[model samples]
Target: MFKGKNRFQSILLFILDLSILISSFYLASFISFGDFNPNYYYYSLLLGWGIIWVGVVLKYNLYEVPRILYVDKVLSKNFSAITVFIVLSAAAIYFFTSYKFSRIFFITVVSLFSFLLLIFRILFLYLVKSQRLKKDFRKRGVIIVGMNQNIQRLISRVYSRPQYAFFIEGIFTDTKLKGRLKNNHKGGLDDVKDYLLTNNPKEVVISLPHSYGDYIDELIHIADNNLVRVRVVPEFSEYLSQRFSIKYVENVPVMKFRKEPMQSLSNRILKRSFDIVFSLMAVVFIFSWLFPIIALIIKLTSKGPVFFSQERTGQDNVSFMCLKFRSMVVNTDSDNLQATKNDSRVTPFGSFMRKTSIDELPQIINVLFNQMSLVGPRPHMLKHTEEYRVLVNKFMVRHFAKPGVTGWAQILGFRGETKTVKDMEKRANADIWYIENWSFMLDLKIIFRTVFGMLFKRDKNAY
Candidate 1:
């Protein structure tokens, strides 16, 4: 019953958005040219824009409202969709069509549509809240059939948010509780079948730990016999650090502890494509001239190689030769000792390069070679990797993606020397967070911040 309502709401939202798009185009025409009648060319343009808008919004999951809706989330999603739709529409016009559309009409249409989408979404949420508050609202009855912290949290969330339209019919657990499960206790596990027959709830939610596998199976069987839907909330929350997801392979369910958006092939492809294009541009425009000057300076000022290559941990904990413009004087302890502020081994010229981040620019070649990405966890020296893997919790989890020239850790001031174990742990945690929550936009944001910091902000951590 809840699923049917969700489907209905999605369809309703889809129709409303398309209607708003059509209305916005005609409205823009009336405002721009003083007539509601638009040309056939304009109509065709409108059709194209409508299709692109649908695709963009669907990708952003705008048709379905989140259970906990925030104003910032609503605005972000709508603005993201609008930006993509307008960019694509403008690109299509510039490339595929010869007819020059009026800039005023295009801007007016997009502005009107964007304004209407935000207003209607807020209005829709208000209406839904108002309707759910009414006594006539039909909330689905849910019977919880287990006891645990997970179950307790679920109950609290449902009861606190009446807008979700769930009525906790009762809770059934084998465990004896005095105060926690007293009010809603319909009896123990043996009474569940009888209560189901009598009450006939819309759904049964099972939240038993793995130890109670037998009880869970029996409850499922009973619920199925009574023609009631069953949903299981896994009790493995204690073992996970973040939200988990289940995937099916050959009809078998597999639970993953962390959700990595980069696991998607489309996202991987987009990141790689951006990396290739951006790296190529850097090599062509910046590196073409800057490399010779830096090499000459290093050679004139130093006694060793201009570039430094060292073994570092890459994706999947594999060893790769990481490249960088040599930023320190040649020393036997280079591999074992990390650079510190005012280090004796760093040359005067190298200090300037390291401070300005010019020393890391040579990794553009690594990106071009497909051994590194534009933005990811910074690769650590082999010694640091081996040492920190044992010291830091989930330290190796950051190796799930290719190491980057500058990463989440570096931009957040976790770069330079790590004098203690806690510093390395902080860097690893940031890297793991990035791996689990990566997006193309996030990479761009990191790049922008890294550049901005390098140009404007003075980093005390950078040596």
Candidate 2:
């Protein structure tokens, strides 16, 4: 029933659990007598533990969280449920098992498992949150047709959660109910159609009493004409928060969507603050060391200056000089040359630095100076930008944010030379995807991926 393909994620989780179980057994044996057998008892314990953990997750509805929910909330619930399960499991084992468990081993295992579970949840949530934060991840906005207390509460909740990423443009209600709404009353119901036409809200939420159900046909007709989404906040007493599936007569099935939780202003402010602080610290601590080393290597190996600066586009299509350690020969015609697999312009040391992404270290200063971000779309050269803007669809849209030191495209194996129009097209696609779906955790993931790639030496595309 999962919306996304997460088989790899499931396998990773299973491996983590298995590791915890096996380590617990080994540690317990080591502490007691340094001897343990892989017998029926061990097998039974592993099976029982796995089943119990999975059952606990199911019972707590951990897997049923809305797609747009923030990473923090999902992880908090998962952690609380898992901790309770571990405690109960330990109690049961102590009372029923013949072999006495070592307290230290039990504690260690519990702590380790808890940590792994939390890490996995954070990583998974970050990935999902990243996707949801994208512009395309937005759900159709719904206007509550009434201003009752319930509808007002829903509006308040939706407005409070940024991670919910649902924009509530305004509310449309009758004159009588309009006075009751604390805020978000755009205009009367009569003005809704015009507003919908002008502002283009994605959906309309009918929050009126049961008596107004008769207008469902009228609402549906309006929605159809405008090609908008429609939803009903039912007044039924047995309402449950559950997802539904939609199928056409002769088409692939699709999952019915749900309204997201509201994000608070404080949360947005806090996230932005975190981004600024984290990006600055990375510039000062990590990139500072690597920048000069790469610069020196480039200067000595090639006749060029230590740093290369080129005019590139930034947020809102603003131009800025993006700096990097020069990786090519001096005075070469940049307009005519794009790096190839064995470019003669690349010095021996420059090629190694490029492969490891050390040449891009100077961009950290850009991030610190607020000229770029630690993560976003990789900046393109002015000539390349001008060229691609003509050839690629929505290429200029990638200038929605400051260029990143490293980016989603770079981490997803799209870095280095763009030899063909198709190659540049793929990178542009990834760049736009990153802009539409930017998130704090996704930035961290890209940073982590970049570091891992560097260590493993996997940038074959770099000249």
Number of the predicted model whose TM-score against the real structure is largest:
1
Q: Which pairs, if any, clash in model 2? A: 134-436, 134-437, 135-436, 160-262, 160-263, 160-264, 161-262, 161-263, 161-264, 162-263
Q: Highest lDDT among the candidates is held by which one?
A: 1
Give candidate 2's TM-score: 0.48
- How far is 452's C-alpha from truth in model 2 (Å)? 0.8
Query: Candidate 1's residue-wise lDDT over 118-147, tens digit each?
Result: 789879878877777787898778888878
Give a tens-digit lDDT track for model 2, residues 301-411.
778688878777787778888887887777557655577888788888878878888778777667667788777788877788889999987778677666888889988
In candidate 1, which residue pairs get closer than 3 Å at backbone N, Cα or C atoms, i.e. clash?
A: none
Give each model's clash number: 0, 10
Model 1 worst lDDT window (10 residues)? 67-76
- lDDT (Cα atoms) of all candidates against the true structure: 0.84, 0.69
Error of 2 at 179 (Å): 54
TM-score of each: 0.65, 0.48
